[model samples]
Target: MTEFSSILSTSNIRGAYKSSQELTTSPVAPEPQGTGESFADVLRNAAQSTVETTRQAEAVAQQGLTGKVGAQQVVEATLELESTVKVMISMRDKVVEAYQEIIRMPI
Candidate 1:
């Protein structure tokens, strides 16, 4: 969870959104050169990582059920999955809030 938090900080999200907004709103500004990544790519990667974590947790759970792994390991995986989901939800909420704010702006 700590690793996830470090990777997806709120400030990073805000900065990315803000930069995209600037690019769209400014006609005189030069287009950003391709750096092999866009905001969508970042989002996709995060989502993929979350899915992978969930799968790992499920595997650990199955192992626990079969007596191949300890209960503590399963519990840890479950907790990590929970935290990852919470972080994703929080990011979704923030994105939605930003969209609504943009919509509320006057033309």
Candidate 2:
């Protein structure tokens, strides 16, 4: 848990790098310095990460079936995967909402 939080804190994960006020006040979210990845690139990376996490959880559960991994390990992986999926869903909802807001805007 601590290790995971440390990793998240160090990584260039979007929202982690900026404050909520900075994000909400700006018309365009500022790209993190030095990464050079666009918003689409970040989304792609996150989607790939979610897929990888799902695969890892499946592998862990399979290992548990074979007695190579403990039930606790399997459960932890499953929980992590669930959290990742929820975050992806939230991001999707936000994107859709933003698009709807844009569509409703008067030209």
Root-mean-square deviation of each candidate, in angstroms?
9.6, 7.7
Best by TM-score: 2
Task: Give one digit per residue, the lDDT tens place, for model 2 in 16-106.
Answer: 2232222223235666787566678767777887788789889999999999998767766776677677777877899999999999999
What are the per-residue Cα lDDT tens digits for candidate 1 across 1-107? 34644545476456445433432332355557864456787677778877887898899999999999987677667766776777678778878999999999999
Whole-model alpha-carbon lDDT for candidate 1:
0.70
- How many angstroms is residue 101 displaced in model 2 relative to the true structure, after the best TM-score fit? 0.4
Q: In candidate 1, which residue ranges exceed 4 Å CA deviation?
A: 1-32
Residue 86 displacement in candidate 1 (angstroms)? 1.2
RMSD score of candidate 2 (Å): 7.7
Looking at candidate 1, what is the lDDT of residue 18? 49
